[model samples]
Target: MFRDWFKKDEKNNSRDIPDGLWIKCPQCSQIIYSKDWNENYKVCIKCGYHDQLTAWERIDLLIDYGTFKEIYKNVAPVDILGFTDTKPYTQRLKEAQEATGLKDSILAGQGEVNGIPIYIMVMDFRFIGGSMGSVVGEKVVRVVERAIVDKFPVVSVIASGGARMQEGLFSLYQMAKTSAAIGRLSKAKIPYINILTHPSTAGVLASFGSLGDVIIAEPGALIGFTGPRVIEQTIKQKLPEGFQKSEFLLEHGMIDMVVERKKLKSVLYSILNHLWRKVW
Candidate 1:
């Protein structure tokens, strides 16, 4: 009877636990309940690490309900180079699309922030590291152009690893294209606010991402033109502690402020309220 009891106890103890119920914070290594983490905008309660959000999640967090009308929805990437590494570029694109439900890395649209109309573009890091490719560039240019025509402010949330390597020169060309479009927006005197997230680096940072009228980054985000390891190797010196983080950038005047995720919407609304007169 004791053997049977032990067997029953073991069976009860071995009952299945659902996956993804808890998440370990990358910054603090604290295991957090998934529900609580999500409720707090995926920010770690202990360490305050701002976790990456999906493009749709960002839209829901920032935009008023039912106010986002996505433009350039049909603009998808094409494998013009037939590039192949471990896998074909087309296959990689297909997988990314399937996995993220995004046609490309970016989602460009018109949205309302506290009833204030604006044009917004949000990049999803899940799609090939949010790499800027031909489609991404085209969509950016088109969105800015639309904002110019509509006489509205433009807000860009940048989260990219860099230019997409698969597109080769085509990807690099987008830096110029996006930067030139932003120049036109500036010429029109429209307010262009850039929100840089973690891993905003390389070509994207060198171009339009850096050309914002007001640049804001989240706390602890990595924002720089090059990775610290490569830079240290090239310079033959150790880099500063917290180098390339948003707070570091702010101290050096590279960014305007480091805002928390929960307060971003109100902050953006305040910016729009202050800048709305320029649009009129």
Candidate 2:
């Protein structure tokens, strides 16, 4: 019966299996149908593990259909330091751009979430581990500034390793820059909802990522200023089990909630509706 259904469905009629027809969950190694995976918002139905989302995918998942208007599209990165390890930084940037179809690791824009207007920023981990460079910082700052001006509630979805190393001090400086931006929004009494996805860490976590008025993290997401391995080495002691994971963070009072991907949109809407109305 399943074979018959696959044959009759026009979308799967081709002799060659469609791209992304099956995805294996990294956590549980369950073979999942692509449609089912998307229907569940890229979460594993078997192990309940949430997969990472690209910047565009995150936007689509959260934003109301046909409502997103992107900001700062022209703000591309510049190679200021002429840095090179094995290859030049510019070459790396080109390759990342081609692969992700984005000028940078982060995307910022305005969109509606369940009829509530919002300004949103999302990071693509595929792009240099979603590094915060000069462009990324500037874009985030601009997005927050726009939110303050328009009085739109803000949402920043973070999935990053840290600040870009190629840009050197330029990247590190973004921490202060973005932090200042978020601070301004705080002064304006704007609600900033931060959703930390898998592996939000390093300078990104130390800065604006942790400054959200309401911080929500996905289940099992790694949230910390440093990697567990580094911490273990530095402290010369074995770390606690599940250290830096979202649930652990919540237990330690580091974050407000550990929301599942399926419930994230509704949870965000509920928070916005409840808090925003009180402020407005």
lDDT of each: 0.94, 0.93
List TM-scores for all candidates, in order: 0.97, 0.93
Writing each residue's lDDT as its tens digit, candidate 1 over 75-172 gives 99999999999999999999999999999999989999999999999999999999999998999899989998999999999999999999999999
Error of 1 at 163 (Å): 0.5
Instruction: Give the clash count for each candidate.
Output: 0, 0
lDDT digits (tens) for residues 53-144 of candidate 2: 88988988899999999989889999999999999999999999999999999999999999999999999999999999999899988998
- Best lDDT among the predictions, by candidate number: 1
lDDT of candidate model 2 versus the reference: 0.93
Clashing pairs in 1: none
Model 2: runs farther than 4 Å from truth?
Answer: 1-19
